[model samples]
Target: MNGATTSGELRAHNRVRLLRAVHDGGATSTRSHLTRELRLARGTASVLVAGLAEDELLHEEPAQEHGRGRPTQVPGPHPRGPLALAADVREDAWELAACELGGRVTVLDVRPHDGTAEGALVPLGETIAAHTSRLGHRVIGVGVALAGPVRFGGLADIAHLGWRSVDVPALLGLPLRPAHGAGGGGATLGNDTAFAALAEARRGRLRDVRVGLHLHVDFDLGGVLVVDGRPLGGASGTGAEFGHMPLEGGDRPCMCGATGCWGMDVGANALLRHAGLEYGGGRGREQAERVLATSEQAVAACAAALGRGVAALVNAHDPEVVTLSGHGPELAERAGETLLRACEPRLMAIRRDHPPRIEGSALGWRGALLGAMESVFDVFLTPEGLGRWRDNHPDQGRDTPGRRNVTHSTPKGDQPP
Candidate 1:
């Protein structure tokens, strides 16, 4: 039999559990609530909170007394706690945000960029550097959501932007600063649609789903399969290329070098095409809105295609739920019945009796940014990571924002290799 758990080991485990509870609870988590949620005795909860407070991972303030009950303390992220920087790179624009432990994101910057993928990196790097300089040692990691298929830690293709087999790290100048985990706070890059799906799984409508699919209809339709609250990636880390699949039989060649790609008939570009407007990267969204405002026929056609493709995917994946992000929610609202009708014919007869629940995403366009923060926090909020954080702040009494000093150390066995 294994030996009894040591005090240090137990403390480490409690720290991880407490931090996770606070993170999942958002800004409303209180010390009393954590005690109940983690099922920890009052004394144990006090010890964990004290330890975390000393390490500057979290802090507490007295909650507002609403009724006759005694006032309790509300737990929140330490003002000096580590922040995760998130970047969302779209076809013609990009945004960066700073995320706290409780999922509160503050937009650091948003800027439109030229369609040239290589040239856009200069400004992107500059913006990241500027933000890092302001946050100093509080930055834990950087997570980037790219609007393309990511393979081998780089972009495999983004035809709308004319990018193919691009080295993302080299382009974005990763490792902009030192971080808690390995590789020196190196950036984690993922497909935007995949990350958005991850966001839905964690905190959106798909939270209750065991198996689900999430689609984001932006300039084009892109999505991923979520299993067990995680987005599934293939061997090349780009398996969720649902948009590239051929669902609409046609002779029109797609930017992905395919004929009849489902995305060609289902996204903003598709809507623009139905409106008799030429495809334009920067103007696709605008033209789609214009079409939706004026033409019912275009909306019905796009919604039908969207539903038909979703039915095909549902047949293949057999998901319990389907969530839409980006412009998908709007499109669904306008053509809900029409979309459902289209799905009925395409779905198997048995599935037609009880189809999956389709709904709009709660995170909206913020899904990718929120998911990026999730990627970083997954690295930072572990037992080993908390231990390292404690070790770095040897003088636990120092509570000021700029007083702490960070040092690099090899990650422990519990950490990702």
Candidate 2:
């Protein structure tokens, strides 16, 4: 149990919700705008705002909109309290960032290390602790975004890392709380690409789109399908391993133990190879950029590979939009014309009228971090958690925003890793 609740606890919960709403909604919405967005009354919104302001979870200011009637104030980024963390583990490097719950991000630290060993996680944990030490005790949970396929809740295997059966939970030494058989704060892990898709869906390109595809092309190409705004994790959570799909008779081998896989044909490594470059240590990055810079040949190869893969998907699922995250978006912009050209022929000719919209990510790299943060928040900010908090702190529950009990379902939003 979380002790006892008071009117103060109620206020805190509502404030968190309001701040989350603003973050999820992208740009800050006005108090009235938030009321409409969250379906709360103006008075209730005001109460929520006042409470958040008291906790410093939100900042409010008088609105300057040229209108009559009662003047309304807009809620802005919170000045302090509670921060979210995001970690990006690429082939030979990692980048971690601290994002305020309001969505502003600060690159906490970036380290170049061979992620091939499970021992690599120790330094990462230390880095995160050092980075957040300045924030006092507000750090809640850590969100990790890995470069390869993360299986289940404990293992992550990526050939680039030469890590098979790596115990992620143990390596990170993440603070583990006793399982209460219910909701509480704990370490949350997400595939980098999946995290990216979540970020894009919630805060980036697919924000309002009902159904879409988010493809992240890194060392390993990964993707996820979103229907009605929620990612289809399928049964095993490895639902969109687009890179592993065979590319007909291609010769190259993939890290996922498959020959002629799409990643062998379309991922960053493929792009690097196309440009006659080697992997490891920024060389591939420089080359990938060069390939995208010199000519559309390398990019065209990627597009063709992606188009074939997409055609198969479109023929089957028929998403409304396809938002490209990571290198996918950058490739689209640099070699978009080629991608479109390649896609045209591969797409279903019969349904030419409704081709999926393919575009770059709106949030760029920030998408992954933001999405990871959201995942962490979901653990402690759910209806159940609020109920627990209320039970422990009864007095705090009365002033809090009342749960509508009515379930309003919206499509899953976008995210990137």
Candidate 3:
């Protein structure tokens, strides 16, 4: 069929528009709200919702209101269907969560893993299988979040994991078809920091803020720039790799094979190292508490390094607010005053009229899970995304990964990394 005379094409396009509207407007509201926001007729809205409901992508519920003119139902959670496995891989531990449609999450398994070896893949695959079996076929997709830079084509550059140029999809294994009563076979992978920033910017803390910067300062320093509520994915998927940036006084070899990197000075490792503890992969929380407990020296250093990073981001993009996530917010609570103070010196005095607000992440550590869940919905739970997947790869449509989920475990018996 010619592109112009294609009924499938029209349906796919409309589906995408409707889903996009729902996404932009956070929680699903009333049908009239969707109609007005999307500029679609009432009948058209009804048809779209009906189609979405058929796919188990959306559940319409009676609106919580009195004297409603005709009975109107708001779009609720996705009908109980397949579950998606979201995995977060870090140096010392792995966390896998089971997420249902509309972003409800249930963490299934947590275990120790090689910070940097293919050996870690074994536990990850098992976790996926175990969770999928428990939840049954409702498992629709898998999303992966790694602790390092995921280069283009979903390759990870995890330093502490000692992983360089590791392909995630190949390592994580494919989603198996349900054995008996099981369901779901979709998958997608992503970077942990990138996914976290996306979740924070869109559904979490920075949602209402239009232009913002999200920084995850942990064992490493990673961040993303959000303009108009969408994080920028630069060419090669490294747009916001903030840790590798060079600093004047810094003098250590970074995992990215660079000297004097910003991350080495500000990340969780740096804080741990400064406190004279074991700077391994799993000591994130312990080290964080140490920073909070000690005489603000490590915290000051983190804030100083982070302040420099924020100032640079502000100067380059001039965002309205810089949202800190992961351990960044915890650090902020301890050293926010110092961070902002450092920012004042770094910012150009000439442009004192507008300085970006240095703020804590609203989503905390759960942002990655929410963001990864969005991709799952995009691939299976939404009318538009599912349609596109069906049209492009019909054979692999149902058995594909949508987004990667991220959760990391800290090692026990450590002061903190």
Candidate topping lDDT: 1
Instruction: Please provide, for model 3 over 130-218, each residue's C-alpha lDDT reduced to its tens digit, 9 standing for 90 to 100.
Output: 66666554666777767776665667677765688876667666642211112335456666777787778667667778888888876
In angstroms, give how far residue 273 of model 1 lies from its true place. 0.7
Q: What is the clash count for each candidate, in the order shown? A: 0, 32, 28
> Candidate 3: TM-score?
0.81
Q: In model 1, which residue pairs have backbone atoms overlapping below 3 Å?
A: none
Most TM-score-accurate candidate: 1
Model 1 bad stretches (over 4 Å): 1-5, 176-184, 280-282, 393-395, 399-417
Pairing residues by index, what is the TM-score of model 2? 0.82
Structural similarity to truth (TM-score) of each candidate: 0.90, 0.82, 0.81
RMSD of each: 6.4, 7.6, 7.3
Question: Which digits, one per residue and each the tens of the lDDT, describe model 2 over residues 1-417?
Answer: 333388666555565567668766542577888888777777888777775555444566667867678887667654444456667777767777665555656666667775555546878878776755765445555678776667665577776557786777677777532212244544676677777887777777787888888888876577888776566665655565766777445866655677877767766777887777786332366667677677578888887777677766676668888887777777777666777776777767763578888888887766666677766655545445444433443232133231111111112221111
Better of 1 and 3 by TM-score: 1
Give me the displacement of residue 395 in model 3, in angstroms: 19
lDDT of 2 at 257: 73
Backbone clashes counted, model 3: 28
Better of 1 and 3 by lDDT: 1
lDDT-superior candidate, 2 or 3: 3
